[model samples]
Target: MSQILLIMASVRPSRVADQLADWIHARNTLGLSIETVDLRDWPLPMDDEPHQPKQEGFDGYRSEHTRNWSRKVDSAAGFIFLLPQYNWGYPAALKNALDHLYSEWQGKPVVITSYGAGGGGKAADQIAQVCQGLHLEPVPTRPALPLKAAERTDAGRLVDPAAAFAAQAADMQAALGELAAALHSA
Candidate 1:
């Protein structure tokens, strides 16, 4: 199976990031392997290695968490980052995680699924730059999920299972499908 890491980029309490990730995952029908990776489970600290990741490599990763996470990135053929915009940017945790690797991410295809005020387009653009710097292929066809039209709220609780989110989910799944095809050709 061509592996694709579905990264849940938000780790906030009472958020819709995971549910959004799940929506993309459930709609995947391309037969590619999809593994959901929640950054919350991997508490990676700041990038403080003696040398850069390109020079240090996975063997230089003294921390077990870093090494294990490296392996996951190394194994993936593509990625889908479920981005929850914060102050018009991606979460710090996601940035730290992406910064912790080098060769493991080289040449891999990545699709951004951004959700927030105005669909997190600013964050998507910023992340695309970051991915390019890492030598990763950032796909251009990103799907945006704006909170007002896409999110369902009931009694002050955030819910995303309503029919309103279906359109956005479908668009993201299409982007994911394109990523899978790009990965095969990459």
Candidate 2:
């Protein structure tokens, strides 16, 4: 089975991105292996490489962290970004992570599962453009998990991802199915 990395894009101390990612990971019915990559574990510096990722590519990474990240991205067949929209865009960590690698993302299918008050539609669109620049193919069904006032805490932590995002499950499932098909065909 092909492996798809579910990248938890938020690294905030009290963030709820992991809860949403866990819910999606647990509910996956497709036969593909879904691995969750918490960005906190990687802890990559923002744009620390001497050369641009395009110039050095994967094999020519100067930093050990970039090399490790390259290997991880290269090993995956597809990706699912468990993202949170911050100020109508994605987190800086996610942008930094994407910037750390280059060709490893080429031609790989990606599902941008964005969550926010407004469903993160703008963030999804923005990331799609970035993905295009890096040559990652964006799947058609981008799942947007919207959290209302009652769905999240005053501190912005998700109350219960499973219950809050129940309505968006079908979208997530469809996106996964599309990713699986894309991987199989690739």
Alpha-carbon deviation at 78 in model 1, angstroms: 0.9
Error of 2 at 16 (Å): 0.6
Colliding pairs, model 2: none
Candidate 2: global Cα-lDDT?
A: 0.87
Give the Å error, residue 4, model 2.
0.9
* Model 1 Cα lDDT, one tens digit per residue, 18-136: 76777777778777789899999988879766656754433587777788889888999889888988999999999999998888888889998888868899999999999988888
Off by over 4 Å in 1: 56-59, 151-162
**Once model 1 is optimally superposed onto the true structure by TM-score, how far is the C-alpha of residue 125 displaced, in angstroms?**
0.3
Off by over 4 Å in 2: 54-58, 153-156
Error of 1 at 128 (Å): 0.2
Least accurate stretch of 10 residues (summed lDDT) in model 1?
A: 155-164
Alpha carbon lDDT of residue 169, candidate 1?
A: 67
lDDT of 2 by residue, 12-99 (tens): 8988877887888866887679889999999899788888885443357788888899999999989999888999999999999998
